[model samples]
Structures are given as structure tokens and as C-alpha cells.
Target: MSDILFSLPVEQQITPCLTLCKKDELPVIVINHPKAKGAISLQGAHVLSWQPEGEKPVLWLSPESNFKQGVAIRGGIPICWPWFGKAGDPMHGFARNQLWQLIAHDENDECVWLTFSLEDNEQTRILWPHSFSLIARIKMGETCEIELESHGDYSFTSALHTYLNIGDIDQISVSGLGPNYLDKVVGGEHTTADKKLTFSGLIDRIYTQPESFSVIADPANQRSIEIHHKNASDAVAWNPGAEVAKGMADMPDDGYKTMVCVETAYVTNARTVTNDKPQFLSATIRCHKNEQK
Candidate 1:
């Protein structure tokens, strides 16, 4: 740990507020700004945790998650890029599995911004043969925002797979997504939500052309989480439920009871990027007191 911290480039260290540290065997950026506290692992440029000064944690990280190289960290915001799901090899592309370079960072009275970059290399070429550059810019403060930008001549599907921490899955409801969705659990069958969504069992549905924002009302926690997105045509709502969670080695059997995924994505309609035109997908998250009922 001492060696890793000492070896960090001077430009990358912000001191007292932001610094490079080792978590297990992976390099992690620890944030201790006055307004919030958080951590980001370079392995995936993955935001592991974030908590505003007076609020509970907004992101969820699995207790059983592995903190090693080449393995997804189970929770938080995982970058599913280039292609989503089984559209390509290794599942969800290579962005989350590859180490990212921290190219820039800055802090201000309102927020701290960090930019991480990942470009196609020999390892990434073996997975998907393409010449490209990916940039992830994250802002942490009273609100958490992440923007993913792609520079290349290609069309691809991607997602900011954000896992949110809830007091209880059964006590919460999600709104703003329109009535139509594709249920992946039922083999991508088209379905309609018809109303605000409440979880009961395994729920994995892709809401197409939904509203720009979605809100999770959590009465149990006396708070609500709102996710606002841009440049995304789709949104995914997921909860593995009890049975599936039991089988996941990285998640506790009851993990589904406290976490829900409301992802910002471009799945059904892949975004195209050219040398002259770069594509972007972004999401901003805010947590506040729920309405009194």
C-alpha cells in the first residue's frame, strides 16, 4: 500500500481530498472532499461508492465483490460499453475489465471532477477489433454525474449500469418510465408496465424511448433517488430477486432486497460515432427526502 501510494504520479495526486491508494490488489482513487466522500477503482474507472455529506450511500457495492484485476466489481456503476450483453465476447465489452488511466482531475467549491481514459490496445483488439478511444468524466458533490464519450468510427451499444442502494426493494417504487418494455427474463418479450413499477421477483426489462428521468420513491428510507440521463434512448430496470441472488457468488442471498439497477443505456438503437462526430451517454443522480405521505 505504501509503495503504491508513493509511486503515484505527482500530477494525479490531489492530497487530503483526492489521492491514489490501493484497495486489495487494485488501484483505487479515494475521495474525501468537504461535501462528500467516495471511491473509484481504476480497474473499471468504476465508482465504487458515493455519499453526500448528510445523506446515506447512493451507490451499492456487493460485500462479496472481488477486488482483483480482470474481474468486474459486482456493484456500483459498471460501464457496459462498445457492445452490451451477448452482442460481443466476454460479455458487456472490455471497458470495465481493463485498467483505465486517470488523465485529469480538479476540485472546486461545488464539486470534484475526475476524467479517466481508455483506448483500444492489443488486449482490447482481441476482444473487439476496432480503433477507438473512450472517456469517462465523473463529477461528485451534492449530485453525482457521469458522462461517457466515445471517439471512433463505429456503431455500438452501451450502458451506465448504476446500482442504487435502497432501504428495502419491496417498499420502493420506480416511476417515469413509459408503459412499454422488453422483458429479457421472458426471452425479450415485449411487455407493458402499465403503472409505476414495484418489485416482487426477478425483474429485468428494458424500457425503450422512456422519459429522460426516472425516480425511485423509498418510503422506508424516507428518501427518493432521481436519475436524469442524456443521449440515451433506453432505460433498464432490474432486480434479481431472492432465488437468483442466492446463486450469484458475488452477491449475498438477500442482496436483491436492498439494491436496484436503473441504468442509462443505448441498447436497442446503437449510437454511431465518426471521426468528426463523437457520441455521448450521461446520467446525473440526486438523492433527497421523499414526499410526506
Candidate 2:
């Protein structure tokens, strides 16, 4: 249906390597072994606007405020789990920037698939000290899906931090959190979120055992992205609130008007994968042209 370019821009970089390619015709950008720790951007992908000029590009991942070592932003369809910001691993895990190689790229005149993988590196070990392999695959179509598999170690935890752009936060609400949840910020106690998790105050919550939940509606796009996940038992919603927004190095004062982070994870007390099994995390996002405003 579409002539997707399944190739990354090839060039040399001083830090590590920056590859910009297209998949199923959609721009797919990736970075390898990024040092000095910069940012990565893909064309048309919704990036976080931290300044008036939007310098930050809403990095698909970020380090947690406290644990500045792990990954945070899983750009595009930010998928976060495992740690779920419960630990001190920054925003999530460190798979985003750990030198991924283009393992497979194929186009059979119909659809395209682009896969990238990152094995345990000396640099990463210094920070995480875990032996593992992380793979990220991006496929294009009416609906795009990215699948992450933790194939090496079983005792691992992580998440996909998707920064969704929405209209007035007041107009949005997330459903499927069902009834009860454990609030990590308030006191690691259980509470009831029977209705949609509304946004109003400095809301930071982690929900467990979600049946099914779609991301908040986007008034600008006039269409909502339905988020579906499997194997992940934890979900987190975060907004810097007001006070933290002012002190942010990359977020604008009014930036709060447009975006929020919906992270999917396996956080509680951390999860370990045994039996040589691959822990899987995936997100499927389909955009509706008919719903476009």
C-alpha cells in the first residue's frame, strides 16, 4: 500500500553513530552508542517541546529524576515497564541508547520490517551491570507496533515511556484502570480509581492489573490512540504538575498544556525472567485519518 523506505541515513558521528532511515515509508531514526548523551528525532514523531524553539525534541526516553542511569523515554509509542519508575533507574531502563545494531531489514514489495538490537556493552554494564539483550522492532502500516524483548536475563525490569501529545489536559481522561491501585508516591498503599484517571492535581500514579486501557483522547488530532499491552501488569501516569515544570531544563513553562507520559511496565518489586525466556513488551498504535480535525 505504501513504499516505505526501510533504511537509516548512514553517516559518521563523533560521539557514536546516528542512523536515520525510513520504515514502511515512515521516518525511523536511531542512534548507536550515544555518548555525551544527546537526543534522537524521527520525522513527524511527536517530540516533547521543552523550549519555545523545541530544542529537546521530547527524547523518546529519559533518565529518572533520581536514578539518572536507566532509560526513560521510549519515543514514538513510548513503552515503559519492568521498573515502571518504581526504582532509581531514571525514567525507565537503558535500552534506548545502548548501541543497537540493525539486525534485519526486509521489503518484499508489500510491507517492510526494521529490527534493531542491543547486547550487553561494557559502558552499559558500568551503569546497569546486567547481562542481557534488548531488541526493538518498528513495523509500519495502518497501525504501528514496536515489540521489545528482554532475551538474556530474567531478573530484569523496564517500561516504555510514551509521551503522548494531547489537547487541554482538562478535556482528557484514561479508562480501564478499573477499580483499585497501589499509589507509590502517596505511600505504597492501595486506593480506588474506579472511574477514569482524571488529571487535575500533581498526579503521579502507578496502576496494576489493567484489563484494557486506551490513551487519553487528543483533541488536536481528534482521534485517540488505543494502547494495548500484554504481560505488563503495571502502568504509570506522570505530569510534572506545576512546580517541577518551572525547574525543568528542557520543558517550557506552558509545555504542560500539551503532553503527558503514559508508561507501561512490570513494576511492583521488580520482575525476573527465568527459564531462558524473553520478557516481552509491546504497544500497538493506529492513527485514524477520519478522526483528523
Judging by TM-score against the true structure, name the best candidate.
1
Residue ranges of candidate 2 with Cα displaced over 4 Å: 1-86, 89-91, 107-111, 288-293
What is the per-residue lDDT of model 1 for residues 21-128, given as tens digits with 9 covering 90 to 100? Answer: 777778889787888878888998998888888888888889888888898888889999988888988788889999999999989888899999999999999888
Best by the lDDT measure: 1
Q: How accurate is candidate 2 locally (lDDT)?
A: 0.51
List per-candidate RMSD values in Å: 3.6, 8.6
lDDT of 2 by residue, 131-233 (tens): 7766777554334456777766647666666666566667667766546577645767576745677777467776777655555665544656566666677
Give the TM-score of each candidate.
0.94, 0.70
The whole-model lDDT of each prediction reads 0.88, 0.51
